[model samples]
Target chain A: MTNELALAALGDPTRRTIFECLSDRPSAVGELAQLLPVSRPAVSQHLKVLKDAGLVVDQKVGNRRIYRLDPNGIGDLRDYLERFWGCALTTFKMKSEQKGQE
Target chain B: MTNELALAALGDPTRRTIFECLSDRPSAVGELAQLLPVSRPAVSQHLKVLKDAGLVVDQKVGNRRIYRLDPNGIGDLRDYLERFWGCALTTFKMKSEQKGQE
Candidate 1:
């Protein structure tokens, strides 16, 4: 998924809460529901969006599916932000130099 | 602005494009319109959202308003992603240990 999709997925407060819950530990839908104020179905729906955004993944652990944060997704977001940071610093430096010249 | 607001503000493709443009250089609304496919008013609208999200800041440069990326906003996004990365690593280590025990 694109970084935009990931950002959009995490844009929701409920989804961010669900993502934070999974960050602490891998969990099943029922467990996530218990941790969050949302219902089981709501958790499931949020999970679907998170999965589509590549922010989380699921693995079948016996009869239950476990969800956990995807490192790659987080890495993508970091990279995207880092790019902007680098550019911002560069622009800042350029502006500073121009001021110094003035 | 909250990170959620920033994320939601960047969720739109047009806003992201406008953000990318700003990263390259500070520009006025007319300049951004020239650089992007969108109209000056559309760029203005996107800039307002970006400003509200703390992703960008504007300063009056004579008769024009210049827009540029805000380092703090980029830093906030990086910090948010890094948190997920740290938790993911910790969870991975714990899962590995459990597997080893099993």
Candidate 2:
């Protein structure tokens, strides 16, 4: 379920751009907005979705909120994608085995 | 762009369910519909979206179309996620280096 949320959060191109920007460095909403084409409020909205999806985290720093990628969230998403590949390989293995039997 | 499309394609719960079912085994539209709670036409529509995203491929067998996970598509998504992690680590490294210089 959480993994689904992360995927959904990343589905939007704007959000993905915001995520990639954060990947380079943690920044406040205004800084992120200046870097991207979107407004500061838009950045905040996207950050909220990313936070809710567990893909990003924010910390209160000197009256400003700084956002960065959440390692745990990234790990969760990576694990999910890895499991998906594993399942696909397993299906292939089963098919090969069935062919051997035939 | 393709990765974004794939992510958007899987944003829905029903679509995710359909994807998980396909991960288990290749199945015809009728078979997938039977396994899922949705109707056959609905399944077909979902399949179309999945196919467009390059996550699933269909092969015509007799009068039926068998759908299975596309390894290339899965590979592309996995690559994108791995790159994301790499970028994060790079950012951390750069930050550490700057701190060392200071």
Candidate 3:
């Protein structure tokens, strides 16, 4: 469920951009807004979705909230992809052997 | 660009479902339609999108086209995720040290 939500949240182009930005380094909403073409409020909304999906986490720094990519979430997403990677490779090997027999 | 296309291709819930099906094992349009709630035509459409994104490959078996996960594309996507994983970890370590200093 968490992986599905993370995937769904990243389905949006803007959200993906925001995610990539966070991966580069942690930043506040204003910084993200400056980096992207979207407005501050739009960035905030995207961050909210990301947070809800567990893809990002925010820290209270002074009066602002700094956002960064959540390592645990990224690890889960990576593991999900890795599982498919293994499955695909196994299928490929089986297909190749079957083709050899044909 | 390729990774972006792949990500956008998988943004849809139906597309993700189709991808998961392919990962389990290669199947034809009819088989996929049977397993999924969507119609045969819908399955075909989703396969087209997946193919266009380089996420799937099809083989002509007799009169049927069998669809399977493209290992190359999966490798690319895995690499992309791995890159972010490394970046996030590095950032996490840095943040911890910085916090220690404060």
Candidate 4:
């Protein structure tokens, strides 16, 4: 369900870059803004997009807002893929069994 | 790498449904068309998109084309999420260490 949110969040090139930057180290709004071509407010906007999608978490350490990847959200994607694979395996097994009986 | 392909492939609602159909069992183009809301050609086109994205594989069983989910592709997505988590954990550890030193 929310996997759609994750995909759409990452659909943008710049958001991916911001997420990549966070992967290295959780940084402040100004810090991330300096690294990317986007301004501070834009970075904040992108971060909001990521957070809402459950991809990243926001922390307030003192006056700075630190953003980092949320493992649960990323893990949710893995679970979804696994479910997909599980469906495939079940199908394969059922088909092969039908063939054996025929 | 190939995940972008997977994402774009699933971006379409119809393509996702067609994939869901295959998840149950591999079926011919005509079979999929009958089960779906679209024409045989449209289903064929969606299957082509899915195949190119590395999400599904095709096998010719006699005169029919059977489609199934590619486990390797779905596994690749799981691995990608795991890598993303690894990056996040590494960053968290580094940040905590920095705070300890201060």
> Distance (Å) between predicted and true CA of A66, model 1?
1.1
Clashing pairs in 3: none
Candidate 3 lDDT, B1-102, residue by residue in tens: 777778878778899888888877789999999988889999999999888878899999999999988988877877876774687777777878999999
Question: Model 2: what is its DockQ?
Answer: 0.56
Report the backbone clash tally of model 4.
0
Candidate 1 residues A1-102, lDDT tens each?
A: 477788788878889888878877789999989888778999999999999888899999898999988877777776776774677877777878999999
Which ranges of candidate 1 are over 4 A from the true structure? A93-102, B90-102
**What CAPRI class is candidate 1?**
medium
- The global C-alpha lDDT for each of the candidates, from Candidate 1 onward, is 0.82, 0.86, 0.85, 0.79
Higher-DockQ candidate of 3 and 4: 3
Between candidates 2 and 3, the lDDT winner: 2
Error in Å for residue B54 of model 4: 1.3
TM-score of 2: 0.85
Candidate 2 all-Cα RMSD: 3.9
Best by lDDT: 2
Candidate DockQ scores, in order: 0.58, 0.56, 0.53, 0.30
- CAPRI-style docking class of model 2 based on DockQ: medium
lDDT of 1 by residue, B1-102 (tens): 467678888778888888888877788989989988878898899899898888899999899999988877777766776774677766667778999999
Q: Over the stretch A35-85, how does candidate 2's per-residue lDDT look in tens digits? A: 888789999999999999999999999989999998778878878877856
lDDT tens string, model 2, B1-42? 777778888787788888888887788999989988889999
Angstrom error of the Cα, residue B27, model 1: value is 0.7
